[model samples]
Target: MPTKPPLIHVLHPGLFTTVQDLGRCGYQRFGVSVSGAMDPWALLVGNRLLGNPDRAAALEITLHGPELLFEQALTIALTGADLSPTTNGFAIPMWTVVAMQAGSRLQFGTRRQGARAYLTVAGGITGPMMLGSLSTHVRSGLGGLAGRAVKKWDQFCVGPAPRTAAQSIGRSLLERYRPRYTKSPTVRVMPGPQSDYFTDDAVQLLTSSSYRVTTESDRMGYRLEGAELPHRASAEIVSEAVCVGSLQVPSNRQPILLMADCQPTGGYAKLATMISADRSLAAQLAPGDSLSFRMISAQQASELFRSHHAELDRILPPCCS
Candidate 1:
């Protein structure tokens, strides 16, 4: 008989738990959202701990995390947020590895920084995909286990363990790799194609004034309440493709930062776009946190983005060495 896979049963569903991979790409032409882990850095770290591919599927835990019971021994890693996680009453280190024995109970406490956490196992979380991704887009009712957050009694299967056992990550690696979580994040921005539509004062306010994240934020977008920007030509622009960092200012004058599940197109005038490199900072901003945008030339933004990736690459161990 084939060996049975380990099973994880959810006892408490935490604040929210969703299955996520890198993202659904190439289907935006079909109007599908590119939903994935909100904090990609955290997801990558979790996968690195397990020696899985960088884009492998992992469980994205939001705010509070769930309580689970394991049916068999397995290696897992938790990244993002200081959730004070424990296994069978023993504390487990973040950005590292842990071995859970059969019947052992795993739980996470309150979050200290950021909102989400990524839990990755050795062989990745196997699941059905919608439009080439296992990520959950709850608002659209697509992807994930059933187009929603993991619920109580929900069970997930784990693949066979890798030949190498989980081990402690080096302190030097941890010191050099983690992203800095700030109370007030300054996100780099590039002026948008529609920036000319806004009055000079509006543009100045966008870069000068600080904004507070609203409670209405979600995976689709983060609505910011701050300096109300006025448009020079109140006329609507044709809907154009919006990406993960597009700052769309609706008629109400409030700016909404498009996120992982944002629509492909919108009518709002885009004042600026947060650079792809700083997007992970946006992911960590909780409601009521302050944020500011610093304008940078597109060329400069691209260079900074590339440099950021290179810095991260330096910390990652060689995959084939």
Candidate 2:
């Protein structure tokens, strides 16, 4: 008889555990949010560490993390937020490949730094894909494990372990390449499509003052409490295409930073848009955490984005394209 396939048994589901990949792209015209890993660089690093493709599906843990029991021996990697991960009662290190024995339980404790983390197995997680991706867009119930967070007792069918996965178990990323999660982070931004709608003072306040992340924040957007961004005219705009990192100011003047699971379109005036390079870092911010924005020219932002990806590629080159 053939051996059964390996599985991941969820013993305790944490705050918001979901399976994610690179995310769905090119569907925003019909109003589709690109829901994926909060930190794609972290996910990519873990995937590459395990000899998997950069877009391999992995588990994305937010704030807290879940306890999972592996049904078979496999190598894994943890990246992103330092959520105090442990395996079978022993603490495990992040940004490094760790070996898990059959029936071993991986768990998380206190959230020391970042707001999210990624758990990448040797061959990544296998599941039904939607729109060519496996990311979870919970608001619309589109992807992931039934388009929702993993529940207690839930089990996931894992893919075949990578051939070189065992050999890379002890490998780890260099210190410089690993990201540092801070309670207060400064992110770079550029003029938005509707930047002119906001007064110069509003833009200055945004860049000069810090905003506190509100509890009401979620994958959709971060409700920031800070100096109100006064608009030049009406606060409303014709519902227009919005993407992650859009700093949309509404009637109350508070800015809402659109995130990974933000709606495809919004009707508020955006004062600025966080650059793509800094957008993922926005995910590491937790409620009560404060963040400041620094305005930069579009050219500078584009150059930074390119340099950022080049560094990420060096962190962990994919075993295959």
Candidate 3:
């Protein structure tokens, strides 16, 4: 008798779960939103732990994690938010690879800390990619399991295990690489293209005061409520290309920190952009989380980005396959 292919059956879909890679690049020019993993760094780290490509598709589990039943033996890695993962009702640690037996059940308990988690199997998630990415843009119905969140009874076909002869089982990340989930996270930012439109007071308020993430927040953007940042001139700006992390302020003065699913172009005045190094951290922030920002020079931001990737390269498992 022939054996069935490996399958991950979803018993219960958690809150806002989706399949995401690094996101669809080069499509923003055509007005396509780059809907990818909110915490791309976590996704990459999970993939690297499994020796998969940096951008292989993985399950982006949100606030309330899902309940899954494995139908075949497999190796997996969990990264990003600590949602208290458990296999066969036993606790499992994050940032480490673990092997699971067939028929084992995976579940997550109350969110102890952090808001997102990435689960990567030894082989990547087998799915169709739209615009070169397996990311799911829920609003437009683009990619990943018919462009929707995995639901109850959904069965996902996982790829083959690591092709390498020597697999790094039980491997773990160093202390420094492990993510820290806190109530108050200080995010770094750089002046945006429309920084000058805001009054000096607005910029100062942005850096000096603490903002609370609002319930309205989503993959599109994080709506903050705090000190109003008044504009020096008209709040309207030419419909210009907008990037993830753009801090857009509308007439109301509250800043909208755009995220992975933001529109390709926006018309609001952008005062600053959260630096790439901190956006992944920011992605882990949840509603009511106290968030603050620190401004950094352009050179400093560039160095941080380069340094982050360099550090990942150093810690990533060898791609023997």
Candidate 4:
């Protein structure tokens, strides 16, 4: 057999690390979850730094980041939470590309603010895609490296960097490109298909109460603890397809926001759906963090989503150009 290509080995798996791309869409009909990067913004920014496509698979590290030893030279970028990343005792800049030599060690410390960080390699991390995506859905064993969290001694191969010279982004662009973690996020929500099932007071509480994210949260869903939302209908609704940001209200009246790894369908009555634009923001929320939802009309939600896409266009260079 031919000798296998060299691969970067995981020295320390940090808090949580998973392989993610844009996501596995269009397979929901087959009951596959759209598993993807939790912090899509970070994933995109990191990819751009390395001149890679937005949909490329990268490593999504949560809370504490990972430490790896590269088997070959490669260009990489880090975005999202500041885990105080350093390479072989030298600090690496965030939202910018840096070159890593073979055998060099990369380490990430505890996070300063947000929960997840996205690390993108130049040509993106090469991996087998299940259901057309490399995103890991541990619960269902659908994608990624055998469908689970990255393990120590696991090696990953990276492709070559772009032939064009790496361009440095201006400080102004850097400031504009990064995600804002300084302020608490106010997520936008749309009244659900079953909103009328809940009392008006419950609707008020859903928007007014400050809910703290419980430690029970994960890639599957965010379990919140706060004011109970009273549903006028005591009976269960038939299970239906659930998407990212579906706020499902269980029998106890507590809301759980379904996430990237959530099941394709759900039985719980959904009270609201967070707009697609804010899904990335919702993913950065950690346990003990407080969040509030503001209701918006569908028309307004569509406009906001368009505006976000426009902003992304401004940052990324044209594909054909």
Which candidate has the highest lDDT of all?
2
Ranking by lDDT: 2, 3, 1, 4
List the RMSD of every prediction in angstroms.
Answer: 2.0, 1.2, 1.7, 2.4
Candidate 4 runs further than 4 Å off: 1-6, 165-173, 182-184, 318-321
Could you tally the backbone clashes for each prediction? 0, 0, 0, 0
Provide the TM-score for each candidate, comma-separated.
0.94, 0.97, 0.96, 0.93
lDDT values for all models: 0.82, 0.89, 0.88, 0.81
* Candidate 3 per-residue lDDT over residues 1-321, each given as its tens digit: 756668999999989788888899998888889989999888888888877777778999998999999998888889999999999779998988888789999999988878999998887887887889889999889989999988999888887767741275787787786878787899999888888998887778998999999999999999999999999989998899999999999999999999999999999999999998898778998998979988988789999999988877888844643
Candidate 1 weakest lDDT stretch, 10 residues: 164-173
Model 2, 1-321: lDDT tens per residue? 866778899999999999999899978888888888878888988998889988789999988899999988878999999999998789999999998999999999999979999999888898989888899999889888989999999998777777888789899988887778788899999999898888878878998899999998998899999998998889999998888889999989999999889999889988888988886678899999999999999999999989988877766666774
Is 2 or 4 the stronger prediction by TM-score? 2
**RMSD in Å for candidate 1, one decimal?**
2.0
lDDT string, candidate 4, 155-263, tens digits? 8977655664155332113576677773257799988878877888877898887788899999988999989988887626888888888898888988999888888
lDDT of residue 216 for candidate 2: 88
Model 3 reaches what TM-score against the true structure?
0.96
User: Residue 1 in model 1: shift from native, Å?
Assistant: 4.3
Winner on lDDT (2 vs 4):
2
Pitting candidate 2 against candidate 3, the one with the higher lDDT is: 2
Displacement of residue 299 (Cα, Å) in model 2 is 0.6
Expressed as tens digits, the lDDT of each residue in 1-321 for candidate 1 is 998878889999998899998899998888888889888878877776677777678888877899999888878888877677899789887777777788999899877777777888877787787888888888878777888999999988876655554553322236556777775899999988789888888778988999998999988899999999888877268887888899988888889999888987888889899998888788877788879999999999989888977876777652331
